[model samples]
Target: MIVKRPVSKSLARAFFCIVLLSLLSTGVALLTLASSLRDAEAVNIAGSLRMQSYRLGYDLQANDPQLALHRQQYGRTLDSPVFQQLHHRWVPMQVQESYALLHDRWRQMDACLARGDIIWYRQNIASYVAQIDSFVLALQHYAERKMLLVVAICLLGFGAILLLVFFTLRRINQQVVAPLSALVEASRRIEQGRFDHPPLETRLTNELGLLGRTFTRMSGELEKLYRSLEESVAEKTLSLQEANRMLEVLFHCSQALNVGTIDRRCFRHILQLVREHEPVSSVEMAVGATWRLQEGEALADAPWQTLPITMQETRFGELRWQGETADKPSPQLMQSVANMLGRGLYFNQAQKHTQQLLLMEERATIARELHDSLAQVLSYLRIQLTLLRRAVPEENRAAQGIIGDFTRALNDAYQQLRELLTTFRLTLQQADFPAALEEMIEPLRAQTAATIQLDCRLSLLALDAQQQVHLLQIIREAVLNAIKHADAQEISVSCVSAPEGHHAVYIHDDGCGIESVNEPEGHYGLTIMRERAERLGGALTISRQRNGGTLVSVSFTTLSGEQTAGRPDNNNDDND
Candidate 1:
């Protein structure tokens, strides 16, 4: 049967020991005191009897001369004076009854002496002396017996005290010390993650057993906490790894799209990139207030047509896409993609404006081909050189020397090419919204092993191409930010129709949340996100979740009836 242990065995054992010892000591003391009292009583009785005998003999002497002479001859006078002094004091009535026969014998002797019966007096005196001697002997015997009883009691008390000490010590060792030692050992085992044995059992029904039960419960809790800690650590490690992979993917995507200006081909390339990186179910694009696809060819109902695209009197087209309805994207992933899209849009637009300013669209076109083909090949070569340099051992002098020279040349060329490309890319216009967002997030999705669900619920057909681009950029930036910063395992991106003919993009993630830094300088992502929203005539809201993760939302009003009526062939894609 399972039984709860006492809480404090040691304390109970100590208390019992103290009580037992006290009782034993008290008993011993009482026994010793009683013995001493009995001894004193015996001594007093013996002395009183001796005094009575002498007093009787002395009183008889006057009344019975012959008896007195006989007493003298028998040597009774030797102790007569001491007895006379004792008899002068009052005797207790309880002892007087035992002395009545002696008193009568003395009177008889006195009477005989008064009658002058000398021979009879002598005979009676001798017999009376014998009786006095016998009484004295009996009192001595009683005193001796009382002394013996006291001694016996003293011995028994000592033995009992010894027994009590032994039992107390034994109980303390068994119930207290032994169990404590076992508990310590068990704790050590548990610390080492070995929870093999049942906790030590305590039979005692006192406090010690209670303590044992408590320890067992504590051990169980500790074990659970340890396991949870391990699991949490493992989970965090996996998340960190996934984040790193996503960053790598983002980096590569940035490198790929960095070479060109915004164009229809770039937009198509962005769609292709998204399709390759993630399992996007549909892609739609709008340009210059027109849908890219024909009316009958449109895939779904466009939702972005009603959203406000003009921000500070500037118009940017919107693009929308949709993914499988069964899957939902995490907020972090959506945020990351959003941020990337915003940057891509800015770059593509700048590239396009540069092309217009130069008035050398054809030259720019040839330059792009050269840059894409040769520059990519050279970049690949540089990457190989970097790997080779790393592979060369430090101790290998010949290989290190060759590798160092090759690496320096490659680094210098790569640096020059990178600078030239950056300048060239700066001249290019930003890609439309759909292109930029798609370009930014594709790499992130490809690099990480995490499953991503992308949902772009905006309608491109009903709105002008510029509004579509704006909405697409907003969604992309929000999604990318979520993926990169929130460290989310899953991201959800959703766009719903808002009141006042506005559209809202909501990005939510299930990951470690962004720190709620009140200052803009503390969080660059939030600052950038806010800036993008403001520039688009939209508001950005970022909030941390209580359970874990971040939620980013952007909402903006679309143009009124005149702008909506301007686009007659608007097609909305419902990619749910």
Candidate 2:
């Protein structure tokens, strides 16, 4: 059978006991066997001596030279190895005493026989035989005692082995087998997703104890991972729900924006939906005084977060809200709110611009009709009146005076009609300020035959359509006045950036200087140009240049155009 390593210290004790008892039993059994063998040999030698002594005595009793042969045979037997063993004194104590007595008797008998005393020889022979018989009994007794000792030792060794095995098996059951069974059961429970294992506390220095500790550590880690996995699942579920809600917002808000259904109520509904997802003290949106949506009470400068309401490249206005800071879901809602607000404002303004376009289209049609029909008739009447006044004789002063009055009235009516046509005209085809400036300067460049240089330096200039129209008209009138009144060539229309972050447009020409730069009689065009500049949130100045040219300059500030606000699209920081 194979023996496993000792489970603990107790097993070691059992093993050591078995080994010690085995060695002791082996030694004692061997000693008993040696004693028995020695006793048997000693007994055999004593018996042989007794037989040889008897033969020697009988030979001595015989007469003639044949008796010498008997004596030689007795001496030869005594010298033999079996009989010679009794001659030694180092035998067992009992055998040694018996042999000593027998030898004394035999020696006396031999002396008597040599002197031919038959009476003493016969007496010594019997005594030697008695000593030899007593030695045999003593050896027999010693062998029996050794045999008993051997049997006792064998029984003891067997008992010891049985006891050691029993104790070791019992201890193995308690320490190793039982612990391993408990661990196996715990593993089964763990496989079934039950983490509550039995406590495995031990102070033993054995393999089982170490395995128990390691298993305990493993169970703990598994429990942690299980809990963490559950938490992760819950987190992902929340994320999906949030994604779904945002999709819903995108769907509904797109409908509100796509159709021309955007208004204050729709914007407020969007803000309310966003507030349902997050917190907001107030959300205020303004689409250039046309539409405004405000919900909840607003606090002033209390860490307000600003967002842009924009669609593509067009911006409506800024949306501002103030509230407590929010988490992942809240920021996403903020972005949706921004997108909804931007689209709502964008579509609403688009509708307003559409209506304005229709109204302007109607006005253009009326102006074209007047210019094409009424204006022609007026021109023809004025010419006919001129010819008719010439046909009237100068001698009739009254008729001449009447013709002059009629001509002057017709001329006044024509001038008013022409001014009306200019007033009703709107040139808003271009969107950018720089492009509009170029378009306005193109015609003047062709008419004046002047090398008109447009030195615009700013990359971006933010101005609403109305501001651009008024600003363009001012530039146009100023350039026309410069050409007509100044008779200038080599004009430079320089639009440079001014201090305090203002944009200045300067028109300079080397032309004939005017007597007065201010409003003069019949200088109504200058007055209208100055008014147009004022409407652009700027002032105009007309002055004669030092190098003999007129300078008409207008400086103005751009509207709301700055960096991008918080990129709520990604739900970044509110202040971003």
Candidate 3:
């Protein structure tokens, strides 16, 4: 197989032609193997036998009514003559023993079933099924292994032929060809500008070795440049990885905004993510007017670099990252992190402001509706009641009492209607908790002669829109109840941090203390307050104030996002 001929044009051509023909023959064998593999899908005898055995067992276990049906299904497979002929026809010598035993077992089981020998039938049938299952599994395993081994042998044989041809060419180059030939080959490889060559010492050590040494020296210099190139590639790869990490951080921040998660430490979390990748001593992100995210040691004492962050022509903030090197972490890197935080914060603020405007607009609309429809009707009823009161007899006690009752009921209805209009008339002007609280309690002062005072120290808790809405509602309900039910001189609202970081809101009034807080017909307001409190994921407590008034408070912890009471499912009735 070592076909290393000297420099002869005709002989070299002849040798190459012969080798090409041999490779083509090998390719033909591989194609034949592929065809055989495709045909192997039709080899389903063992699998068929396995299914038949299961069918026979199922027939034996059938109920009285189903016995005939199961028997018919079973007869189509193993019980029929076709399966028997198939089982005996191939008769391979290697599996002759297993085939003969299976054939005999099938006949015996058939005979037992026919004669109604229950005990022997059960015993022999179980044995027959087990043997067939084992044999089928064995056949399947053999087939898989045989196919894999055949493919592996063919591939390995082809590889060996290629390896043989390669060595034959190497032998021809080294032994038959001299140093001049080596020089010629080396020059050609050099012309291609590929420096990956075998050792020069292994080749002829004459002028060829000197030429190889020269080429090796040139490649070694080129190797220094290659090493420098590899280092540059590694640096670029690291930058790419850092960039991807920053992208993921930005993606997570975007999610926080989408979920309406109002986090005061939003920028801090983002900076911490940056510090994870960059070699920075500290990071400070000055975002907007009041929110500044500072992490690591305060960089006040040390001189730090700054990168201004801007979005949509509005310069919102700047990022300052202090590190060991002056130019290691680029300004672009610092600004990228800052821009994400700034833009995200800006987006969140814009969304919140837009929502507030929409809410106010909708509230105004609803207030107009209540005034136009229900308020008009209440006014007409009140005027009629006044006329009726004037016409009543001045001295008749029973008539006067009835008239008074009617007047009081009409007044209560009008008051409730007016209160509904007032509730939908106003809106939350600001997103802050304290500002919202102050705005909510403003109307209760005008509605009642009672002095309303708000005492809030709720800085620790950050609540989203839904929680704020629910809290405001609960406070409103409490205040209304105090004014209507509890005739109080002074009403004080307290919002302070509770134990375990929970926030408690308390509204107290020096008014009539209820002996009963049950859900009576007239006490619908208390029920509404309780429901709003539940929406805040907290309990509403109504107890006697220390000075003979009412104290209503709601206590809740931090939340993930805005949450509300789910509407009852009308579609569930259809399912039922």
lDDT of each: 0.55, 0.68, 0.64
Q: Candidate 3: which pairs clash?
A: none
On residues 255-276, what C-alpha lDDT tens digit does candidate 3 reach at each position?
6445453454455566776676
Q: Per-residue error at 21 for model 1, in Å?
A: 9.1
- Candidate 1, residues 244-298: lDDT per residue as tens digits? 6556546655655666433333444554554455434564444343334211223
Stronger candidate by lDDT (1 vs 2): 2
Q: Which ten residues in a row have the lowest lDDT in candidate 1?
A: 567-576
Question: Distance (Å) between predicted and true CA of 446, model 3?
Answer: 7.5
Q: TM-scores across all candidates?
A: 0.36, 0.46, 0.45
Q: Which of candidates 2 and 3 is the stronger one according to TM-score?
A: 2
lDDT ranking from best candidate downward: 2, 3, 1
The better candidate by lDDT, 1 or 3, is: 3
Alpha carbon RMSD to native, model 2:
13.7
Best by lDDT: 2
For each candidate, C-alpha RMSD in Å? 27.9, 13.7, 43.6
Q: Is candidate 1 or candidate 3 better by TM-score?
A: 3
